[model samples]
Target: MSMIQTNDFDHVNLIEKVIENNYMTYFNYDEFTNKLEFENSISSANWNIIQNNLLINITDSENIENIIDKLIDHLIKLHDEFGYGFAGVKQIIEQNIQYINQPLLNNILDWLIKNQISSKYIFFHGFLYFNGII
Candidate 1:
């Protein structure tokens, strides 16, 4: 009888593979403005790339919920460390939401609400305040 073979991989390896396979675009913050600008144009290819990459990375992790929780922690840390203005915070949250699952987004929203941070402030006022950044 013939037997099928299987392969085993770790979370880090999975994340690397996911990133390599997807997320064709990369960006860095502008030194002068401290703003994140996409290096590539916004297109279907780019959107699919990013979405697939994030999905794979999160799915491969041991605990997806933990990954999202850690991401929130990092966001809080960034806010504390860099004193990210409301606009910056909003942008970060929006970007994260776009990449993460709905449940994770809901958790983030709930956390922000519990902290007395209004979603409206982050959505509307935040964009208006940082129009120049975009």
Candidate 2:
């Protein structure tokens, strides 16, 4: 029998990372753009971590439905509270769900709909949605 570990703290750490990079301290357009670029890099790195973790469970044939459900739930909460720029995060999530046959994909989409959360909330949603993760 395999057991699933609830890594709420890990999720919290991810949220903190998002919050730490999403805000502007000053109003320099160039600086703001640079900061956003940096934040995008960090977000990519975080998504890699999340993807690796999910791959591990997929290899093990462990049920990841709960894990994905919790992740989306946490993300929605973070967005609602902090409005963190979640474009990268949403991209990663959409990709993973499309590439992997996970039951929790439906849960994620459901949560997004119920919360009225859209890819538009994230800065890169326009590009991503045009590419079709709307």
Number of the top-ranking candidate, with TM-score as the measure: 1
Per-residue alpha-carbon lDDT of candidate 1 for residues 7-118, written as tens digits (9 for 90 to 100): 5434345545645786322333222232223334211121211222222234433354455445555456646774554545555645554666667555544544454455
For model 2, residues 1-134, the per-residue Cα lDDT tens digits are 99998763565566456468965222223323223123333221212223344321322243444544444554565356534346545644565546554444454445444544554334233433465764
Among all windows of 10 consecutive residues in model 2, the one with the lowest summed lDDT is: 25-34
In model 2, how large is the Cα lDDT of residue 97?
49
Distance from true location, Cα of 85 in model 2, Å: 0.9
Question: How much RMSD separates candidate 1 from the native structure?
Answer: 18.4
TM-score of each: 0.32, 0.28
The CA lDDT of each predicted structure is 0.44, 0.45
Please report the TM-score between candidate 1 and the true structure.
0.32
Error of 1 at 62 (Å): 4.6
Q: Residue 113, candidate 2: how far off, in angstroms?
A: 8.8
